[model samples]
Target chain A: MLIATALASVFIRDLFAVIMVFGIYSLLSAGFFLNLNAPDVALTEAAIGAGIAPILMLGTLALTRKKWDPEPHAKKSTHTPLLPLIVVAITGAALVYATFDMPYYGDAEAPSHTHVAPRYIQESGQEIDIPNMVTSVLASYRGFDTLGEVFVIFTAGIGVLALLGFLSDGSGRKYWQFADTASLRRHTVLHVIAKILIPLILLYAFYVQFHGDYSPGGGFQAGVIFATAFILYTMISGLQAVYKIIKPELIYWTMAFGVMLYGVTGLVAMFMGGDYLDYNALDHHDPIHGQHMGILLVELGVGICVAAVMMSVFFNFAGRGIRLPEDTKEGGQ
Target chain B: MSVVLGLFNYWIVIALMMTGFYLVIATSNLIKKIIGLNIFQTSVFILYISIAKVKGGAAPILEEGTELYANPLPHVLILTAIVVGIATTALGLALIVRIKEAYGSIEEDDIREKGGTT
Candidate 1:
């Protein structure tokens, strides 16, 4: 099924169909992760890959669909695909051939299993005392790498803002006339359901955030899920209500504050005489407690930054002031 | 037969990767290219998780009485990678939007033929 979708998406020119099928590809990826005994990874893939990424892609299409779709200029089909096919086939054959030397699938003695993973699995029980060893490794054993990951996304968020921040075409609207309602009047059911679902989604995201220490979700999944609640509300209820609630300025502040909190937690650890990001010093009475405290702090920081950044990016993308069909009519009225 | 049973997963994932690679190189549509990139990425992720699989192992949660577990390292690594993948995708899509705005078309051939910055 995953293979079929990938192949279909490759040939499909209808951008909307391609995005939908590509979402299926990601959902399949999540199921693939679950079959391999990686539920934590599966959860993140399902949420971001299938859930948020497609929505963002669709939001983009909403703006550009007018300018690009339905086979404009039929002559451009002149490009031949034979050269790329031969190249991909050779590269793929090489990869398959190299796999002959790899350890058999599911071999317990595979080098990846033989090394650091064994320690993470066996000792994380006592060392971090977290039920989810993936979280223990993500937040404690490999804390520095996770810190770098947060920074990578932080930089990505900034890149998105720099590119789209000044994009408003200045129809002189003080804010989006999101509820400058034409299409929204028809979405009465959508508004009511969003009202009910948004709070529930936010509650689940909260559970996923703090409960991550014990479960499949963590800061990464939780943050995106949290931001998703708002994105959902925006899609249904319109951006005007959401922007009034979470000022654009507030989202930006929270984005920086989340990064600062993560950085400051490390500094606080350093000032207390432990290494940077050393949670043990946070509470010397019990190193385990310190680990818990430190993981909680960093995860909170990650959750905040990720949620804020996702919202910020969505707002910028959707709020490019390109004016949807109904939005364009608002100026005339 | 033994080799097929042993290495089937890798071979399939490699095929998927190549499909993505083919889409990236062969297609002119920018959105299709991004989708291709994503497919390629997800396949590589599957490859890693397959490596991390231990026969008869449980998920990596530290449960009582569960002695064998899949490798947590790749889960930790790929978990972050998945999020980073979206981040990069968003960045790429943002660039594509700007490209559309400036060049008036996302097609590579169009951009090149129109001779940029009209």
Candidate 2:
């Protein structure tokens, strides 16, 4: 069933259908994770991967065409398949061989179990006072990688905003018209639901942010939950409300602030006599306490930046007016 | 029963991931490609979650007289990944919408043609 859904997603002609299929794929993947014993990851996957990504994809599809024209010469020629076929064959063979050499599924004796991972797993609870090993790994031992990931998200948000010309003076004009009475009435149900859910989601985000030490929650989940609330607001109330709530200038500033917060936290540690991002040196106190404080502040930075960047991207994309072909609009049911 | 379920599930997850990736690379429609990307990502979630499972283990919460529990680490990791995936997808969709408005079609070929000719 999953294979069929994936195939249909790729092969489907209609863009909307494809997007929906992608959503299904995400949801299924989340289910797969839940079955795998990773409820936190499953929650993240379901929310971000399935829920938000598909919605964004669908919006993009609505703005674009339903069908693609084949390349002019390729349609007339028959020479493309042979090379692709051979490549697929060779790749398949390589994959099969690699599978054979891989450690048996869930083998406790695997090399991964014998190395730094087990040590970290064994010691993390005592060192960081966190039962969740993933949080400990992400925020401390490999905290730098998390930093890079946060920056990458920030960059992507900035890139999308630039692409939509959000910096231009005239870009915000069209989207600012207050929601019409009729449209508001029509969307009241959605609006009410969003109004109820957005606050809860934000509260949950904070819970995830602070509860990382004990449970399967952290900065990324919190950031995403925060972004989800705003996205919902934009969807139900239109881009104008989102703009009013978080003006473009504020969005840019907040994004920068988030990144700056992260950098400053690290710099403070450095100034206190530790290496760059050495959170343990933040104070002349116990190293673990310093580590805890540093991780908290840094995760807050990540959550803020991620949430801001995501909202900015959503606004930019939705703000770009759809320019459908005249015929499609006229011929609509 | 437990061992068989674990092995079979992993294999299926791996298969889905590969197939999804293959489609993403091969498809022409931008939306289809994104769908493929989602499929590809979900597979990784499966792999991570599977690693966290422990034989005869329950949920990772502290419980009376229960020492064995599934690892919560992977679950935590997957949760974050899920959120990121959603953000990426939402952004991707928004881009597609704008692209449609600007170029009149979501098909990769059509967009390329317009871009090239212009």
Candidate 3:
């Protein structure tokens, strides 16, 4: 089923249908992850693959709608298929050939099974005292990689801001025209449902935020759901309504702050006479408790940064006022 | 037959990956390329996960008296990878929008015809 969706996306010339099919492709992959016993990954994949990717794509479509002709005749491919087909076939064959010597799926005696994974599985309980090994590995053990991941997200946010200019469309003028309250007031059903659901989603985000050590969620999932709640709010009430409630400056600073918080946590550990990002030295007297402190702060940092980035990206994509044909040249006319 | 059956998951994953590869290079549309990149990304993910599975193991969340558990390492890496993928895709889509604004078209040849290299 997942492969079918992907193939459909590849064959479907219409961008809108491709994006929708891509969403289902992601959702099915999430199900596949669950079947393989990677719930931590499954949670993040579902949130991202189905929820945020489509929203951003749709927003891009809305802005670029004026550029593309809707007529089917405009969808013809200009590239020849022969070279690309040969390349793809060769790559696929090489990949499959490489897998021949690999241990069959799920074999207990496989190289990976005998390596560091078992150590993380067996000793983490004693060392980190955390029930969720993925969280401990992510937020505590391999802290540097997660830090890099956070910065990647932060960098993307900055890139988008430079390109699209979030709050005023990178210029000083009012970007959106219809931020008027009538947009939300016109749809009472949407308003009522969102009013009831947004708070609950926010509350659940907090649960995932704080309970990551014991469960399948951590900052990434929590931050995604948190930002998603705001995205939902924006969708229902319009981007202007969200800006009214949550200052755009606050969101921008929060993105920077989340990354900083992660850095500060590592620096504080360094100041305490331990290596950078060594959470064991966070509370030297009680190392487990120190691990707890480190993981919580880092996860909080991740959550805060991710939530801010997601919301800002959505706003930048959705906030571009209406794109007009005259707005095309070197500068906005 | 059993040899093929035993390794079917890996083979199927390869086929899925090439589907993405074909879309990316065979098509001229910018959005389709992004979607192809996404499909290619998922194949790698499914690769990591299927390799991590243990026949009798439970999910990586530690529970009392649960002896066997799937590998937690790949799960950790893929978790971050998934988010980074979205971040990069967002960046790609943003660039595509900018291209549309500047070139007035998203087709690669069309952009190139207008003297803007895709």
Candidate 4:
């Protein structure tokens, strides 16, 4: 079913069908992760694949709205397919050949299973003092990698901001003129349902944020969920209503603040004479308590940055698609 | 033959990966290319996950009487990767929105002809 949807999405020329099929493919992959016993990953995949990815794609479709013309354009530049085909075939063959040496699916003796993993499972209770080994590994053992991931998200947000600009930027007003807001307002069912559902989603996001130490979720998933709630609100209420509530400038500040919080936590540890990202330095009297505090603060930093970045991205995209009536009243020449 | 049977899941993922790779290269539409990229990425994810499984293992949560558990490392790594993937996809789509605005069409040939590069 996954392969079928993926193939359908690729071959389909109609952008709407392609996006829908992609959403199905994402949901199916989430199911696949569940089967693999990776609930945390499965949850992220479902949220990202089913929830956020489609919303973003639909937003793009709205902006573009280029009909799929079956008839090829007269000036369609000639593209050679032979080279790309050969490249793909060779790459595929090499990847398959390499897999022959890899341990068979579910083999306990696999190198990945034998190394570091066993220790994490066995020692995490004492070292990280967390029930969820994945959280312990993510927030503590490989904390540095997660730090890099947060910055990568931040960089992407910065890139989008530079391209799309803020919602209130005067220079973007011309593009905003073409934005179609009346269509978004037509769905009252969605509006009413969203009004009921958005608060619950925000509450759940906070649960996932703090409960991550004992469960399958953490700051990353929590942030995405929080951002999704806002994206939903923006979809139904129109970006204008959201703008009145939360300024675009506040989102930018929050985005920077999240990353800075993560960095400063590490610096505080160093000043306390522990290595960077060492949570133990946060509370010298009780090292375990310090680890707890550090993880909480770090995850809080991650959640804040991720939620802000995702919100800003959605706002930037949504802002690109809608024109305020006031803009016409003021700028229509 | 038995070894081949044991590893059949890996082979299927490889096939899926190739299909995605083909679509990415063969498709002319920019959005379709992103879809293809997503398929290719998810296939790699399946590969990581399939290898993470231990035949009799349980999910990696600390509890009494659970001896064998799936490797938590891949789960953690892939969780981060999934977030990064969505971020990348968001950026790509944003670029597509801008491309359509500037080039007036997201078709590769149209963009290539208009701007001499896609």
Candidate 5:
């Protein structure tokens, strides 16, 4: 099913259909993760891949659908598929051949299972005092890598900002106006439903954020869900209401501040006479308490940065105007 | 038959990866290319998760008397990777939007044929 949807999405030219198929592919893959006992990964995939990806793609589609409908020029299909097919065939064959040496699916003696994992499973409760070993590994043992991940998100947000100018900039405001509508005047049901559901989703995001030490969600998933709540509200209500509530400048500040917060937590730990990102140093009484404090703070930082970045990217993409082929003189509206 | 039974899932993963690779290279549409990239990334994610599975293991939540558990390292790694993937996709789509604005058309042939900015 996943492969079918992926192939269908690739083969289909209608951007909307492609986006929906892509969502289906994500959903199916998320289910596969559940089957594989990786619920945290599955939740993140479902939220970002299925929920947010389609929205962003739809926003892009709205901008470009005009040019797509008329197919631009009838003679613009002079591309060859033979080369790609040959290259992909060789790569696929090599990958398949290589997998023969991999430990059979679900083998207990698999190298991945034998090394590092058992220690994480056995010691995490004693060391980090967290039920979720993935969380302990993510926020404690591999904290530096996670920090880099947060910054990568920040950089991507900045790249999007540089490409699609922020709402504060006068240049992209016109595009926002084009995408914006006054309200959900026709469907009061949608408005009411959104009003009720948005708050619950935001609340759930917070629960996921704080409870990640025990469950399948963490800062990344929580942050995406938090951003999704706002994105949903923006979708149901107009952009105007959301902008008025959060303000564009606040997003930039929160994004930078989130990264700063993560860095500062590490510095605080260092100043406390421990290595960088050493959560044990965060608390003098109990190293486990320090780990708890460190993980909580860092996860909050990640959540803040992720939420801000997702919202910023969505706003920028949605705010940008679609460039029409007829308007050859000037760029997008 | 033994090999197929043992490594069938990995083969499926390769098929998905190759399909994505084909779309990314063969397609001229920028959106399709991004979708292809996503499919490819997802296949890789599946590969990693598949590697972490234990024959009769529970999810890696430390609880009482749980003898077998899936590998947590891959989950940790892939968690970050999934976020990175979406970040890349978002950035790619944003670039495509800019490309559409600047080049007037998103199709590669059209962009080249018109002899506009590459």
Candidate 6:
């Protein structure tokens, strides 16, 4: 059934059908995660994978024409995808072969288990008081990666905003009026849900932010969840409502603030006579305690940036309709 | 027999992953490509879950006097991946909608034609 669904997703010509199949594929993948004993991961996959991605894709579909009408002249390249396909297959085959050499399923003796993971699992509780090893790994031990990921999201937001001309003053102002008021009123279900969930989601985000030393949640998940709530609001209540809540200037400023928070935290550590981002130097406290404090602050920065970036991207995309180019004579004037 | 079952499942999932990836990279249709991406991602999820299963082990949830339980880490990792996948898809679809409006068709070739650039 999974294989069939996958094939159908690829071969199907209808854009809408293809998007729906992709959603099914994500749903099935979520089921697979449940089988693996990762409820946290399963929840994220189900919510983001099967639920949000498809909706966003569908919304894009609505903006564009439904039928895929390729020009006949463009059909001349019959063998275009062949070379790339072959290269991909070879790489995949190599990957599979490499996997065979990996430790067998659930082997407690696997190298990964023997390596830093065991140390993380054994020491993190004593050091950081976090029961969730992944959270500890993500927030403290490998906090730099999370910072980079946050920057990636921030860059993506800026890219999208620039692409849609939302960076310019006139274009940005005009774009705010993109979503029709009728559509905004029609999606009352999402509006009500967002109204109810946004605060809870923000609260949970803070909990995840601070509770990282003890639980399965952390900055990344919390950030994404918080962003989702805001995205939901924008989707239902429209760009105008979102603008009321978070103006375009605030979005840009918050994004910068997030990055600066992370940077200054590191800089402060440097000023305190330790290396960059050395949380252990925050005070005269134990290195581990300093690390804990640094991780918390950094994760908060990450969460803030990610949430802001995601909202900015959604607004930039959704707000595009209002800014029909002046030269095109289609500005809906 | 059990080993064979495991190997077979792995092979099938890998094959499905390849096919999905091929379609995604090969197809000019934006929607079809997203479908292919979904298939590819789902295959990875399968690979992770399959690795988590212990042949005779019970579910990972601990209970009174239950000693054998499958691993839980992979499931957690896959869950995170799924959320990331969904976010990417949502953003991609939203992009597609904007693409359609700007260029007038979801077909890659047509959009390129309208824009006069690939």
Q: Which candidate is the best by TM-score?
A: 1
lDDT of 5 by residue, A169-229 (tens): 3564544444356446458899899889999999999999999999999999999999999
Docking class of 4: medium
Q: Candidate 4's residue-wise lDDT over A1-333, tens digit each? A: 887887687567677888898899899999999898898999899989898888888877777763445535556446556777798789878977887887888889988888899999999889778888889888888889999999999999998887766444555453333544635677878778988999999999999999999988999999999999988887777766777788878989999999999889899999998999998888989888989988998899999999999998888777776643444456556
TM-score of chain A of each: 0.92, 0.86, 0.92, 0.90, 0.92, 0.82
What's the residue-level lDDT of B75 in candidate 6?
Answer: 45
Model 5, C-alpha of A36: deviation from truth (Å): 0.2
TM-score of 1: 0.94
Ranking by DockQ: 1, 5, 3, 4, 2, 6
Candidate 1: clashing pairs of residues = none
Task: Return the lDDT, model 4, position B109.
Answer: 79
In model 3, the runs with Cα more than 4 Å from the true position are A67-77, A166-185, A321-333, B116-118
Please give the C-alpha DockQ score of model 6. 0.34
Candidate 4 segments whose C-alpha is farther than 4 A from its true place: A66-83, A166-182, A323-333
* TM-score, per-candidate, Cα-based: 0.94, 0.82, 0.94, 0.92, 0.94, 0.79
Name the runs in model 5 displaced over 4 angstroms.
A67-73, A166-185, A322-333, B116-118
Candidate 2 lDDT tens digits, A1-333: 777787676556666666677778767766766665565676667667675676566556544534453322334332233464455456656665555555556565555445665566556666776666667677777767677777767777776776664423355543334232123536777878878898898898899889866776677777777888887877777666667687877987888888888888888998999987888897677888888898888888887887788777766656654223333666595
Residue clash pairs of candidate 3: none
Docking class of 2: acceptable
Off by over 4 Å in 1: A67-69, A168-182, A321-333, B116-118
* Ten residues in sequence with the least summed lDDT for candidate 6 chain B: B60-69
* Model 5 TM-score on a 0 to 1 scale: 0.94
For residues B1-118, could you state the per-residue lDDT of candidate 1 as single tens digits?
Answer: 9899889999889989999999889988787889899999999899999999999999888888989999999999999999889998999988887887776677878877778445
Can you tell me which runs of candidate 6 are displaced by over 4 Å?
A1-4, A66-100, A165-174, A177-179, A182-194, A323-333, B5-9, B41-103, B111-118
Per-residue lDDT for A1-333 in model 1, tens only? 889999999788789999999988899889989999999999999999999899989877766656454868578464589899889989998998899999999999988888888788878888889999889899888889998999999899999888776535555453354434224636778878888999999999999999999989889999999999998887776677677798988998999888888888888888888999888888888989989999999999999999998998888787764345553466459
Candidate 5: interface RMSD equals 1.1
Interface-residue RMSD per candidate? 0.9, 3.6, 1.1, 1.6, 1.1, 4.2
Predicted complex 1: CAPRI docking category: high
Cα lDDT tens digits, model 3, A198-268, are 99999999999999999899999999999999999988877778888998789999999999999999999
